[model samples]
Target: MSSVDATPIGAGAKARGAGGRRPIGLLLVAAPVALVLGLIIWPVALSVFDTLTVHGPQGLEFSLEAYRFFFTDGFSLRNLWLTIRVAAICTVLLLVISLPIALYLRFSETRLAGYIQALALFPLFVPSILLAYALIRTLGPNGTVDTLLVAAGLPKMPTPYLTPWGPIIGLVWDNLPLTLLIVLAGLANVSRASIEAARDVGAGSLTILWHIILPRIRGTLLVAASFVILGLFSAFTLPYLLGPAAPEMMGPFMRRTIIEVDDPVQARTQAVVTFALCAVFALFYVRSVARSRREQTS
Candidate 1:
């Protein structure tokens, strides 16, 4: 009698074994995820809890004092509004400056590509606070820029250092390179064949850019803008060093609340509010990424 193929059964058993090992592989991944969750969840949850309860001069107590302080507190809304405004301004400036540079890097075949990339990232290597100091020395009273202006028969201009504009300028300088890098990476994935096709179809450069490149890279643009917004919003060093005597950032205020005012609870509240605002933007960014991936796959 001819034996039915036992070899087929053996092959099927091997395939089943491979499939069974996948769970073990997944279990391995879960360990690091669990570690991260363990580290992050507690602090975040505690802050949220703290935001609900009150810690009066007497001690910690269950009350809405923190939120009350945030809402009824003078200048809180003004500072929050200013923070949002600054973030919006920084996002616009970053995009306007970085996008054209990114496009040039992607479309140009010049050898200066390496030089340009290095130059773009050079600011990133410098620390924010250090950059602030450097800017001050170059543009502050009797600084290089002022001396140059005087030599050129121009009056010495007032230094912008340690002012509202100081932090804004510093934030842009610090974050511009990173924004450019992200946009450039996105532009790299634009289909060259598709661009050429558009050109063949009598599409002008502007039309091709407007229709083909922008739509394809919209996700990247959003991601870059989100990063700039979040970075500027949470910025500490540059704003602390370069901004006015009382900068309107949650960072500086949180420090004052905690250290100078000796109110840990208020500081925690500010931290949570700032984090929550940024978290909302982060969630949108993640959603955009997911949608972009789905579109690409479909």
Candidate 2:
């Protein structure tokens, strides 16, 4: 009988096993990683390329002229400031409003807790355009708000639509669901025993919340705030329908630059600027999530 080559069988088995794992790993990890990288990197790369390149006497030359336009133009500067202001205001408001509601839901076992939670999430179910239109109908001239006042035989106030406050209100409404969900999730992780123990020791609700609940979920609040800032800074739909034309938010400003003014390069430059500002809040959100996970793991 011919001597069989045992090495071939063993080596073939090893090769098959390794080959199988390679494909599986590629499917499980590599594909999704590639998808995410494409989603993130492509837009950023395009924005940077467009922003930094300009039609020169030669062919295309790299310049910071797009950024310079933003700095030099009064409207662009005001638009940037408006975005920053809106983000800051919305973040603070969400913290104030969502935190208490989250805490209440955390502690409540009443019949209405579910209803309240559902109500808080109502904005998420509604389409943003629909919501924006609803806001316009409520705040526009002789719209629902004024009509209700007229029906009540009261003086109709000036229309608040097409103003900063119109979009601000819409943003607040849209952002509430996300804020509530984050805070509520954080509250879920709080030790019920710890809270009850504090209660047993005669700690008041305010004291328990301030000392216990707040400390426990501070990271989560920061995460929520970061997300709110990111969303509000790059907001498009709400700002488009509701905001004023003079001092546009970054989203509408970039849009108008492209469509109305026919300046795609400038629009992309504004996009890069918006992305840079949002990166700060994105970093904070990442760090907050990392810290929360590390704490949980420990």
Candidate 3:
């Protein structure tokens, strides 16, 4: 009699099933992938091409005149510098404000933790335009804050409204929910046993935090910073409404370049430069994610 086949029927069927599903999976995602390529990738590629090439006496030759002008122009340079500065400050502030809250949410079991978390996430539900108007009413000249100060027999402190600080404050508030969520997710990965063991050895809160918690979440912090910086770099509404008339953030600056100055080339160049800067941070974020995944798998 012929010997029966050694291969298990179930294993063969399973392998065939998986192979069959691959096409279906690809088919399901094909539309979205195509949309992304068509909508986002194509436009960005065209914009970059437009920014790099110009109609010269010799024809459509490559030129950096727009970029050179952006770098050399005093107003453009100031706006770029201000955008960078504001992004840096907001990133730092988000870290400082979010980390502690994340830590508390991660470690605490009290009923108040829920309330605090809800409060932290409240900004997510609020629209940016509404938030901007609320900020104006609450912090603008002779607004709620000034009125309170006057009533309390104290000098009215300088309002952040309509200044560099305005965007900083608005950005920090707008971005807090996302930053806190990222930090909390990072904190979730910390081993409770490790924290408890450190505590058993008489490690104080700060010591444990410094030696244990911060090290574990360093990658997460970098990812959060990358996202915040990227968003702030491209931010328009907050910076436009709240920022100064002169030396505004890149968003308003780009808008004004397009509408007021009517310089599409300059605007495109600025966008390209901004994209390059954001790409650096985006790469960092991707590497951090990849490294974290590798560590988890290994």
| C-alpha TM-scores of all predictions | 0.86, 0.86, 0.92
Scored against the true structure, residue 98 in model 3 reaches a CA lDDT of: 96
**RMSD (Å) of each candidate, 1 decimal:** 10.0, 10.8, 9.1
List the lowest-lDDT window of 10 residues for candidate 3: 1-10
Q: Poorest 10 consecutive residues of model 2 by lDDT?
A: 1-10
Off by more than 4 A, model 2? 1-23, 55-60, 150-153
Q: Which candidate should be chosen as best, given TM-score against the real structure? A: 3
Q: Which stretches of model 1 miss by more than 4 angstroms?
A: 1-24, 55-62
> On a 0 to 1 TM-score scale, where does candidate 2 land against the true structure?
0.86
Residue pairs that clash (backbone atoms under 3 angstroms), model 3: none
Which scores greater on lDDT, model 1 or model 3? 3
Q: For model 1, what is the C-alpha lDDT against the true structure? A: 0.79
Model 1, residue 109: what's the lDDT? 75
- Model 2's alpha-carbon lDDT is 0.82
Error of 2 at 28 (Å): 1.5
lDDT for each residue of candidate 1 in 91-188, tens digit (9 for 90 to 100)? 89889898888888787778997688788889989978689889889977899999999899999998878767778888888998888878887887
What would the per-residue lDDT of candidate 2 be over residues 1-298, giving only the tens digit for each residue?
Answer: 0122112133344445556746664455555457767997887797798888888999999999988987898888899998898888878888899888888887888979888988998998998899999987888889998999999999998776888888888999999988888788777768899999999999998999899888987887887888789888779999998889868899888888899999888888888888888898888876776665566569
